[model samples]
Target: MKRYAKAVWHGSGKDGSGHLTTQSEALEKNNYSFTSRFTSTAGTNPEELLAAAHAGCFTMKLSFVLDEAGYYPERLETTAYISFENGAITASRLFVAGIVKGISLVDFEACVLEAKVDCPVSMALNIAITTEASLTD
Candidate 1:
């Protein structure tokens, strides 16, 4: 299946504004701007959207990975932080917390590594990806 999103930017890059619209309109022409992207503005930006996508995709991949490894998590909370540097996105950090059982540390680490390589968003990002996970019984 193919999915898509569209970004519409108006005016110059430094003084411009834009909104992103998804095919399904779930985002519904949400606002983005240079100020929002570069500074602390109360608006949505590309980095924020990337963070959301990374977090969601990683969490789903982790869930599947854990299940395949014979561990079922009661809860999984993930955060993806995207860092923008020198006019480019340079890194992403995945922070995860969960309650799981039926797996050892080695197996869990292996599953996480697999997810890091296999998750669609992770694969799409051309940046460094790091992860931290805390699991409990």
Candidate 2:
């Protein structure tokens, strides 16, 4: 149950560039550079990847939580915003929307809160994690 990724960097930090490859090949040799990370350059960065991971993890966990609560979701969408400050990750904010049949908004929010805290990625992070969840019709 272990996952791994590889990063290969060249040159100095500011002037250097790197490529990342994941075990699943989902990000095979994706380029990342200082400009890509610090500016609006079109490339992938660690924070972006972490955000995707968090969103995916949280959504999946929410699905499980809903199932355990005897509710099946028709759809779930989540976006994770990762905040970086002072060379550290400060927070992860999750915005989620779910469409489930026969579930109250309060119950859906409770499931979202449980998933936000119980997800693997959320538990692994040592930063603030907040969620804004909405149950849709």
Candidate 3:
């Protein structure tokens, strides 16, 4: 399956504004601007979108990995931080809290690692990526 989002920008770099539209229109004309990206603003930005994608992908991958390992996950919560600096995206950090049945901490950590490497968004990103995984009841 292939997916794509389109963006259109108007005006100069620092003063320009843009909106992103996805094929399914789930994010319809999501506005973004230099202020939104570089400073706090009332609109969505690319970095936040990346963070969302990374978090969703990693969590989904972790669930699959756990199931394949003969474990059932009761809950999994993931947060992703995307860092942008010097005109480049520098890093992505994933924090995962997991609760599962029939898995040791060591094996749960191994599953988390596998998800970190195998998730599509993680694989697509060229920047440094790290993950912190914890198993909690």
Q: Candidate 2: what lDDT? A: 0.95
The best candidate by lDDT is 2
Measured by TM-score, the strongest candidate is 2
Worst 10 residues of 3 by lDDT: 97-106
For candidate 2, the per-residue lDDT at 75 reads 98
Local accuracy by lDDT, each model: 0.87, 0.95, 0.93
Could you tell which candidate, 1 or 3, scores higher by TM-score?
3
**Clash pairs for candidate 1:** none
Candidate 2 lDDT tens digits, 17-127: 999999999999999999999999988999999999999999999999999999999999999999999999999999999999999889999999999989999999999
Q: What is the Å distance of residue 62 in model 2 from its true position? A: 0.3
For candidate 2, what is the TM-score?
0.98
Please, what is the TM-score per model? 0.90, 0.98, 0.94
What is the clash count of model 3?
0
Which TM-score value belongs to model 3?
0.94
